[model samples]
Target: MSDTTTVGPDTAGIGRTRTPTPFRRLLAVETRKLFDTRSGKIMTAVMVVLTVGAIAGRGLYAGPRLEVLIGTAGLSLGTLLPVLGILTVTGEWSHRTALTTFTLEPRRGRVLAAKCLPPLIAAVAASAFAILVAVPVTAAVSAVRHVPADWDLTPVALLGWTAANVLVVAMGLALGMLLLNAPAAIVICLSAPALWSAVARIGSVGETLAGWLDLNTTAGPLMEGHMTGGDVARLAASVSFWIVVPLATGTARVIRKEIG
Candidate 1:
């Protein structure tokens, strides 16, 4: 005798056409997951608190120029966004839920894309929040310091601040996809710049490499609202190395890695 099981009439594909889960739905789920975990909640709270602190510190330190306020908020976010990005991808793997996730959505590429998009969205949102918060903070600072505030924000400034946040977070996502271990991904994402800086101190060759490939140096001009063609070229080169390469490799790994 052969063992057999009966499928439900509605679920057996006999009476209905099954639609693939929508990508938008996947995005929604992924976005919700960002705030659903305890760690995620804690990280978010920390980010909020840090941004306020950074904005206040900058206002008090140098007066509340719009550009400086946005930059300070972005720098504060950059410090923690990597961890959030890392967990976005690695959380499932680290928590042993990859099997379930892959089972539901067999297309690994979509899953990876979904994981990547939310961090980018968060980066954009963070930048917007920074800008909004800067306005009130600027007014408050002017009152406290009795100096007029500079509200000389430009489109380039907005793009630059957002881009910087996106860069750090994207790097984190890439590392998480490559490593699939939250701790490992977070460590590398945070420490690689320092490691690179150490290497850059070795000699003139290192300096040249840093000028071209160091993300901080290349992205600095864009953030400061004065990027030239050479700066653009260097930024592209550095982004290709730092963000694109690992992201490609990591997607491959995610697709190939067996979920156990």
Candidate 2:
């Protein structure tokens, strides 16, 4: 009354083992995932468009000051870069691919760590892009204005700029991982700076909290190449709050969360 099929060697191999995916490959895949979805593509396109637009707008309106030109693009990059990091970390959960991802690479920590590299790399790349674009824009504007461009940029300043972007992106990644929800994480990521700014204007306590915790203030002197011993202490405190806490909690959650 029933049909049955018996499978042998050709049908299955019970003792087969497969090589694990390399960490490098995991990083590569994560990078590709950045452009694999609609939101990702749109965000990426917007970042490119805005960066170029900011550089062009500043170059046309103001004289060619290298720091000013780089800072112009940083204004947009500072906001959007974290958003990109948020999307990168949350995309898996938002798209419901976490199960499959964890199934393939059971070491969730490695996967998560690999996921973070792209954003950090993008940070460095973005700063470099801004600097490179500034060079051409600086030359063009200087030629037009017939004035020498400011070549006062130092290696410390460049490192500080890149570090600040990386820190912001890391905050995004940490928040995204901690929340595991794209919309909520993005909203918080965007709202947080505004909230801190408003609070910083409240009173002495607010100023003290912001001075220690708000990256906007802590990172300012560093970007301006005037980082001092006190700035270092403030920057360290800000980094601990913005990056370490969320990332630590998020990693723990990812390690133990059961996938359906």
TM-score of each: 0.91, 0.92
lDDT tens per residue, model 1, 1-260: 86888765575656675688999999999999998889989998888888988898888898969888888887778878888999999988878999999989999999889888988888888778878888899999999989988989788868886888899898888888887788888787777778779878999999889888878778888887788999999999989888899899999998998877
On the 0 to 100 scale, the lDDT of residue 159 in model 2 is: 89
Question: Least accurate stretch of 10 residues (summed lDDT) in model 1?
Answer: 8-17
The superposed Cα distance between candidate 2 and the true structure at residue 104, in angstroms, equals 1.0
Segments of candidate 2 deviating more than 4 angstroms: 1-18
On TM-score, the candidate that comes out on top is 2
Worst 10 residues of 2 by lDDT: 6-15
Per-residue lDDT tens digits of candidate 2, residues 98-146?
9999999998998998999998998899888888888899889999989
Clashing pairs in 1: none
